[model samples]
Target: MAERIQKELKEIEKNPPDFCSAGMVGGDIRRWQATIIGPPGTPFVGGIFKLSLTFPPKYPMKPPEVTFKTKIYHPNIDRNGNICFNILKDDWSPAYTISAVLVSLCSLLSSPNPEDPLEPQIAAVFLKNKVQYEEEARKWTAKFAMS
Candidate 1:
């Protein structure tokens, strides 16, 4: 196991995030499974979202690949579970930790960023009809994420 990976695992174990829980997947420190609880007052409240993270050997130097395992109806996430968050992309820095990533994800759920969307259709709906978007997102959360 990589030293960085071990260190991250230890940190996560010591100080877990409030809205999420994450740990090694199948005993592989490089692979992680995360469950993020939806934030209150959002359309996603009461939903439990699952995610997968795969770290590169050069972790802490490079951002891990993160994907939503549970279905979500958000502008920043696509049907294929790909997330288009800036922190996971060009804005990433080694100073970020796994806990930081999870907290950021929780924030994203609480507030969707329609400006930079992975699913343009969803973004359009979110921008044009916020009520409709919230309705659909809430429905999807109840249908898919609740399980």
Candidate 2:
């Protein structure tokens, strides 16, 4: 796990996204602390959201668990941090790497998958009222991510 993360860290450092950054927590090889700048052209823009990534003892063979430690108002993420992204679930492939997962997560930050929602009310809000959806999302971002 250490070697894999060391390599990944180098890759991340070499070509990091402007909106995000991640590092192993407390110098532990298996746990990471990450921050995502909410995507542009979305209500979440300008917010800095936090998350934790925990790799399995046998990573690569199995997917790691990722959760948003900072509360966010998104249809695909539940209050309990259970992500409803397919790539993290059944759609995952052994060829996928941490960078791929982070890219997926960043994509999700702007374009949520309404078809596979974790918070039904939020999904409904997204479908029913775009203004309200953006407002609440911005509110959550300010409350949980900006500070």
Off by over 4 Å in 2: none
User: After aligning candidate 1 to the native by TM-score, how far in Å is the CA of 76 from where it should be?
Assistant: 0.3
| Residue 4 in model 2: lDDT | 78
Model 1, residue 58: what's the lDDT?
Answer: 75
Global lDDT of model 2:
0.86
Q: By TM-score, how accurate is candidate 2?
A: 0.94
How well is each residue in 33-103 modelled by candidate 1, as lDDT tens digits?
A: 99999899889999999999999877777899999999999999999899999999899999898899999
Residues 1-147, candidate 2: write the lDDT tens digits. Answer: 667778887787788766878888888878988788898998889898888999888776778899998889999999987799988888877688777788789899889887779999999999999899999999998888886
Compared with the true structure, the alpha-carbon lDDT of candidate 1 equals 0.92
Model 1 clash pairs? Answer: none
Which number leads on TM-score? 1
Clashing pairs in 2: none
